[model samples]
Target chain A: MIELYDYELSSDAYKARLLLALLGVAWTQRYVEYYPRRQHRAPEFLALSPRGELPVIVDDGTIVDDAQNVLVHLASRHDPTGRWYPQNDAGLTSQVSTWLAFAAALTPTASAARLHDGLLYHHIDVDEARRGAHEQLAVLDEHLWFNEDAGWSWLCTVDQPTIADIACFPDVILAEEGGIELRTYPAIRRWTDRVKAIPGFIAMPGIFPA
Target chain B: MHGTSRWFPVIRSEEIVPRHIAFVQLLDEEIVLWRADDGALNAWENRCPHRGIRLSIGTHAGSEIVCRYHGWRFASGSGSCTLIPAHPSQVPPKAARVRSYQIRERYGFAWIALGDVEGEPSLPELDGLPHLTLRSMTFAAAAADVAATLASEPGIVVHDPYRAVWERMGDAAPMLLLLQPESSAMTTLHAVAGNDLTGAGRLAFLRAHNAWCKEIRPRIVSEESRSAQASR
Candidate 1:
């Protein structure tokens, strides 16, 4: 059995939960109170992740701290078809890697803004975070528009969504909590709908199942 | 400002896809537009009555727009509050409703009448010809200034402060330009080209006119700003 050190409201943790659910893998969640109690930064939790991240998954003897790394581990290890990680296709692998890195970039701006507004992290510079989020959203919107024009869906050129879509989904869907509106990015809005319609999809607190 | 009873074009009809929300601003009022699966069109105040969050961020669930904040769902056409996810067993009160505006689809545009309206919305003459609606573009200049600039172009006729008919200098079919006043300093232009041509010809016309609009937008804004500075 896999044990996920999870925080309910954390978008990073939700990414791990989403992929785990989509993979049809049963994992027990070790709840970590991220707010008020701040259990994620406790000494015991810091032992697992030196960076004190809320999501640290321990599967069998292997342990993964970062959310994206956990996703890679699950897909590469468990998915027999190799569709999620697509290790066989070099081009698709590179595209997925690029978007996964993009999702990491989103954590500081989009996720930080969510922490500031939703979780009451008053120390964050919310204006700068929101501005960064909008810039990223514009690039994503343009990319989605071009994809739609070409009759393709998902973040990459593949017919089925890779882990890249899952990596980027949480923050873009919940951006409004951070004072970032998706109204201007109609293409991105449409892409979110496509993401929600995926099979075995589960909704977190902020996201609703389609 | 025109009378509140008049209908204004909020967005193109194709924009309000089924089960998707379209957000547009008209005369300083933000409007949320959606089309139900039953083909009913709805225009509302773009806000959830519960928490005043913009309903444009919400999802369109076939017949209703569900607010993202607290899962409050507003029914299509009526804009009445239907279900509160938190209180599933209890029915909501009659007063729980978002203000809905009268909407009409004419000439490939969604026309919204903000206040009490009388007759049908007046639309530009297309002579019952098949037409193609171009992508709407926004300009930084005021509606009047944009309209004035377009009217000054050769073979262009201004019907009013917000409507104009343009005759291309060559063999292309004439087109109509409708200006939507977004704010004191912004305007949106919607164009309709006559459909006498098809295939590559139609594509050529659309690209040329689209480029023409793009070329004129910055010039109009610059000219208008210069005049405003001189007046000051």
Candidate 2:
């Protein structure tokens, strides 16, 4: 039995659920409350994590901590025809790699952006990161080059939305809140639509409580 | 402690510790790290200056710190106005502030930067490395500087495609670099499971990492040295 531990609104958990929900995988969930502030520090929670991240899952007692790992595990489990992960496709591999990198790599920037949007109008200190994002986005934007023959693929060459799209789109979709306008990039906006059209797709919750 | 221009990295992150109240390292600033006697990481500029508090001395008492001196309590990172002593809120913002760095925890470490940063700092890469217990270190260089150091020499040799790429697919590479500035940086070099990676294969990867470090790093430094010599 697959037992999932989720914290309701966490994107980390969402990545896991998005897959399970689409695959229609039956799993029991245990919701943990972590919002009283600093609750993750509780020994019980820290015990589950050495790095202390969330969206961890247990497959018959084997604990998976990192969210990206969870996604890969899910994709592999459901990869019947090798659609989600095309073994022959480095395009898919490299594409997926970029987003996974963002989710894990750009986290520090995301946390700062949240505060920037919340407390101050200007995000003065993270300019270096903004420039960094621009570089990353440019690369992503270039990869997103869509055409009649090659159009709107979600982080995969299969012409379908794979976990790769699921991974990259969330943070990029919310970039506007951090003063990043996704609308500025045509390919990004188009790719966002493709993800929405996929089955078992759930829209990102609105900011300020939806 | 090197005192090389103490930098209070701006509010570069949002989450510090979900449980323990701890302060992250600021660029070079003398940061006050403490838990509000409660279990929260509350950080401030580690200077008291009034009678010179060294703010770290205070502990959290429900989102407020009781200045060990006479049980004084101040709310917020601004270090302003006491609630316990019921001091007037007009304790001028300047006198009350302990200066706090915005902190966030991701991957496995807590990062705090001083001042208001522009936008957010994203998570770094995690694929390609061994997911063993990660030991990270930061030097006085931006991610871009390091990336430049790495990019100019994209020299990496994989022992086995399965081990380096597929088997350790989820693990980020040994050098997941992002260039941020000229100098001052953060790079997480991870080592994965040693189970399948035997002594020889693992040693090979290590040798590659060391060689990459040795090969590229010195070139830039030498180039800089030559330039400095030429200028002199």
Candidate 3:
């Protein structure tokens, strides 16, 4: 059995939960109070993750930290059809890895703004974070717009969705909490709707089902 | 607004697919645009009358739009509240309905009129020509200001206060552009290339125009900001 350390409000943790449900894998959630209690930074929790991230999954004594790594690990090991990770094709694998790295850039910008506005993390420079988020979103919108012309639905130039879609979903969907309106990014908005329509899709606190 | 009675292009026809809620703003009024599965086009006030929640964030359930907050369902054409999931047995009041606007599809674009519009959207330049709609872009400036700027350019022809048209030097097809006033400080541009392009040609044409839009957006935004600073 796999044990996932989770916080309900953490989008990073929700990524693991969403993939788990999509894969139909059995797992047990170990709730860790992230806000106010600050249990993620505690010594006991530091032994599992030194950087104090909310999501750290343990599967049969193998521990995986970081949201992107956990996604790659789960998809590589569990997905029988090899559609999610696509590690067999070198070109597709490189493209997926590139988007995974791009998804990491959202944490400090979009996620930081959300933290400052919604979670009382007043120490963050929200305006700067918001500006960075818009820049990133514009790149995403342009890419997705061109992808539509090629008749590709996902992030990569593939018919099926990859881990890149899952990696970027939570931050982009919950961007409104950070005062980031998606009205200008029409392609990105449509992509989010397509993502929500995927089979076995789940919602978080701010994101609604399609 | 004084221009409320006139038609303004809000979105491309293909963009408003069935079972999806598209949000747009016209002259500072938020609107929810959706197409029914039965091919009915609807443009309504973005707010849910029950709690003022944005209907743009609601679900498009084939023939109706369901408010995300309370699960209130409003039907397609009439905007009438059809069902209240909390109290399904009771009939909803007649007044419980969304305010709808006039919308018509013309030349591959969705033209919306916020007030009492007289007739269908008539454009002489388009005259039933084949066109490829480009991706829409929003600029941080007033619509009139953007239109005025374009009118001053060398080759661009200003058809009306809200419309413009231009052509590449040797190309047979003309590019017709429409301006949508999202607010006093924001404007969105919807464009169509008057040509029947397909496959790679369509992609290339769209990309070229998108690049042009990207170049112009910053110039307009910067000009607006500079003028705002001077006025202050």
Best-performing candidate as measured by DockQ? 3
> How well does candidate 1 reproduce the true complex, by DockQ?
0.21
Candidate 1 per-residue C-alpha lDDT over B127-157 given as tens digits, one digit per residue, 9 for 90 to 100: 6676778766667578888987887688889
TM-score of chain B of each: 0.91, 0.45, 0.92
> Which of the numbered candidates is closest to the native, going by highest TM-score?
3
Q: Which ranges in model 1 have alpha carbons more than 4 Å from their true place? A: A36-47, B1-6, B47-61, B64-75, B80-97, B116-232
* Residue-wise C-alpha lDDT for candidate 2, range B159-231, written one tens digit per residue: 3111121133443334332221212333222222323344566545545543444345434433355457669
Model 3 chain A worst lDDT run, 10 consecutive residues: A145-154
RMSD of 1: 4.7
lDDT of 3 by residue, A1-210 (tens): 789999998989988888888888899999999997989999999998898897999999999999999999889888898998998789999999998988889999999999999999999999999999999998899899888867888899889998999999899888899999998887788899998998999898999898
Chain B TM-score (model 3 vs. true structure): 0.92
Candidate 3 CAPRI grade: medium
Error (Å) of candidate 2 at residue B53 is 49
lDDT tens digits, residue span B183-226, model 3: 98889988887789887877788889889888776556445565
lDDT of 2 by residue, A139-158 (tens): 56545642211444565555
Name the 10 consecutive residues with the lowest summed lDDT in model 2 chain B. Answer: B157-166
